[model samples]
Target chain A: MNNAANIAVDIAIILVLIAGISRFRTPAGARFGNAMAALALLFAVAVALYRNPMLSSNATLAAFALAASSLAAWRVSAKINMTRIPSLVAFQNGAGGLAALLVAIVEMSGAGPAPGAVASAAAAVSVSLGAATFSGSMIASLKLSGKIRQTPTVVPGHNIALLFLSAACAAAAALLFAPGDPTSALVSLAFLSLAFGALFSIRIGGADMPVLISFLNAATGMAAAFCGIVIQNRLLIACGAVVASSGFILTMVMCRAMNRSLMNIIVGGKAPARPPASSPATASSPELTAAPPAPVAASQPEQPAADPLSLAADALRAAKKLIVIPGYGMAIAQAQSETVALAGMLEQAGTEVKYAVHPVAGRMPGHMHVLLAEADVDYDKLFEMDDINAEFAETDVALIVGACDVVNPAAKEKEGTPISGMPVLNAGDARSVIVCNFDDKPGYSGVPNPLYERPNAILLFGDAKATLASLIAKLK
Target chain B: MSDLLVMLVVFTASSAIGYVMISKVPQRLHTPLMSMTNAISASTIIAALLLFSSKLDSPHKVLAAAAVALAAFNVIGGFTVTGRMLKMFKKQ
Candidate 1:
């Protein structure tokens, strides 16, 4: 019966994995996948109950506690704001890591001081990595929620501190391998891991948050997998392996999108300073200077600032092909619905409307897509950076709504800029560019955008949603 | 195969399969992909359940209980959040 149950559990896990994969193929598939996942959970629970030898009073008490905590966590997650989803993800990853850490501790304590070398080593690795993931993810969540500052908080001699922490963890693990009381060493290992997680995570700046979150997610999965090894749990080993690998792939994707080194993100420091503007002008490359200069009228003041709303309305009235670009600012101002409304209005007026999205545009990956999807924006009308970049030249109006870094021309014109070498949308290629941003502030990277200085660009200074709502009203 | 060896094979095969499966996901669905994987990670609740049911001393029992609570929280919260998020992605 035990053998049959084991095989059944394994098959159920395989089915769950298949369902997870099928979710990507279609919307209906996603719904089915979610159902399969619930079924798999029920199967796992049933198998666990069947295999359990002790139905003692202690077990019942533990089960009740488990039910209460899980119910509370579910309630909190269901009520969380959509904008704060990244932080919620971070918190859940932290919870997984904490569970792994506790499991490792319990397994080690049950085995007593002189556990076998293999068990000891597994426990050591699981405890250290799990503790690290828990604390690191907590700090990431705090930063995302604005409870903590988002800038890199590097201590003096941060590298030396990290090296010392690594050495301590290694020493603790080695002590556990030796045949002796490992309790003190385990405690020290947990302490060092927690400290290292906080130190490492807080040093990362806000701009690299997506990469950091993905990396920590992978680390938590790896920790859970190691915990499974220590405890000999096949289900954890299978699920953790899947999460760890996928998270690793996602981390690599995020790094590639930013054109940043993974090691650089981990070490956590400011990007190289851009060259000063006063330096003898390097011959601007042909592609960099390709956008036609905004025509200046001789009779106008030295820097004529066009009235943004009128300019945007005029461009929209004349536009044949219109493209909207959104970024983190759009998320901040809750402008997605307004932006979609504007797009719909433009489409009604015999203009073709599309949205161009940068992969890492908002606080998390696919953030803009979710926001626009919530507003009932047509998915087919949305285009990724690579797909839409070439279409900008043929566009009559590139309506840049609360976007800065992705459309900034500095990525092309200058070297050593924070966003240099990162792929950017070609908003500058349009016949007219209308920017709906309150100010000419540098974005998360803190590199000033030159797109605002372009002559064909008109800046509308106001909150994004309000600005878009007014534009929609004017167009109507 | 030895238990450890069987686990190693399972780990390697599953990881490779996961990479291939997740890579096919569109960029627009990345967030849901993450939340769904998170739900999967909660499978460690099985380990916690077994630990709680196994024979142990008083201190170990307390620790085991804590692990069960944490793992259960992960499982319930993760699946619920993923379901809520996926429901929001309906085509209008």
Candidate 2:
């Protein structure tokens, strides 16, 4: 086959892949897009085989491996619940990284002609990054799956250690071609990079997980692209590059949503120190300044504390418009169905109900939407933070379930705090607020929530699933 | 050497276009979008299969086969899972 024909085929395949990505603008379109992207990959595999036919014996083994692993993936994905998708995706990302690592190693171990300076460099970098991404993704998967404690474990001298390991990995990669036998340098680079990846990921606190996970997705894609360069496969290079870019964009979007720089997340720059309780004098929002301090705030819910549920029930009963905000806590408590049911009941009561989703609300980006959708909520009823923030004031009631940080007014109003500068849902802006969180405690960021103290807000603290059930029962 | 240049151009071009194409994936589909991209990166499966096209030694053959399995799992699992997630999204 001529080089020109191969190039044309690759361009066509790449275009199809791009078209697939473009279809992700909506849920229905994304399903079609996902299939198109999968088909494009199928085409890539066909073209590669056409260019270089496999030996019969080798082909049989490869086919068996593909079928077995694919069946396992299918079974697991089919059975797992929506809540577990984050961990599953992370594990799959690690698998892709493992492939890139193995391919880079084989190519670097004298597969082709003695590689030139740049190709050797690319191979070394690929292996190092691939190894790092695999280990990092595994740790993330474990944390997300509840297999490991989900806490930011800050090793002593964490940042310094990461910096040293990064420098060492770079040095080893550079020295890869310096030694006659590059195996030692290559191995050391891989080990150093693995350590770096683990250390860099471990200290990132839970609140910053969306950024870390998204960034790792980008890193693995980058490693695959470098591997493609080593093998000189244009199809591999194009596909890898596309994934890298997609992951990069998601990383930036998640970071921007939280108003934190990627560096702030990876380096543990923000401290989760608890803010002083009830510091009205330091309240950042100007409108909040005139509100009387502690006594009224603390006793607000207690006056009707014995019947907070009924108060919330009455609030919902009278509400002409309601907004529901869901957080990662809702998923953790398995309250999605109850939340959706409550929304449905309210809609039936002539209340115009809508769900407001904060971008960083769940374990991963768009995770809240998936959980809500799993409960059969209409996509039309779901509103993004930017779209629904302004509507909260006009709405009669804001129903918060298993959520805190996203609706916490402090994140948007406070300064010199962990969640400072983070854009949050304007649940406080609603005419009346009903909080169904587990307690009045602060959220993942450890910042105190001033909204819980608002006089008009009803605090129904308990397991969101049970709380939502009772609320649904009352409303029904 | 010139082949290397062409490859570099391909990588740059694809990334630039893919970024523009994907930047519009709404927040609602971010999770599915990510899983789909995860499958795309599995294109390394092509490189893995190509290793089998040649007469590699037994150990290299084993490594190549393992790569093929991992990439296939990533590809098939990623797409199927994304499809399921997207399916759950309904308009009412």
The fraction of reference interface contacts (C-alpha pairs within 8 A across chains A and B) present in each candidate is 0.60, 0.88
List where candidate 1 sits over 4 angstroms from the true fold.
A1-5, A111-114, A273-306
The CA lDDT at A375 in model 2 is 97
Q: Every model's DockQ, to 2 decimals?
A: 0.64, 0.84
Off by over 4 Å in 2: A274-306
Q: What DockQ would you assign to candidate 2?
A: 0.84
Candidate closest to the true structure, highest TM-score: 2
Query: Relative to the unseen true structure, what is the C-alpha lDDT of residue A331 in candidate 1, on a scale of 0 to 100?
Result: 76
The residue-by-residue lDDT of candidate 1 on A1-476, one tens digit each, is 22766857676766686565667755556656766776776676666667665558567867786888888888988897777788888888888888888788777766544566667877898899889988998999898888999877889999999999999889988877765567777888999999999998998866688888888888877887787788666667777888898789888888898888899778746575333542332333222232233353322455355345656787899999999999878877888888888888888889999999988887677778777877888777888899989999999999988888788888888898788888889999999898887556666677888887787776775688888888888877
Q: After superposition, how far is residue A156 of candidate 2 from its true place, in Å?
A: 1.1
Residue pairs in candidate 1 whose N, alpha carbon or C atoms collide under 3 angstroms: A294-A455
Clashing pairs in model 2, backbone N/Cα/C closer than 3 A: none
Model 2 global lDDT (CA atoms, 0 to 1)? 0.84
Q: In order, how many clashes per candidate?
A: 1, 0
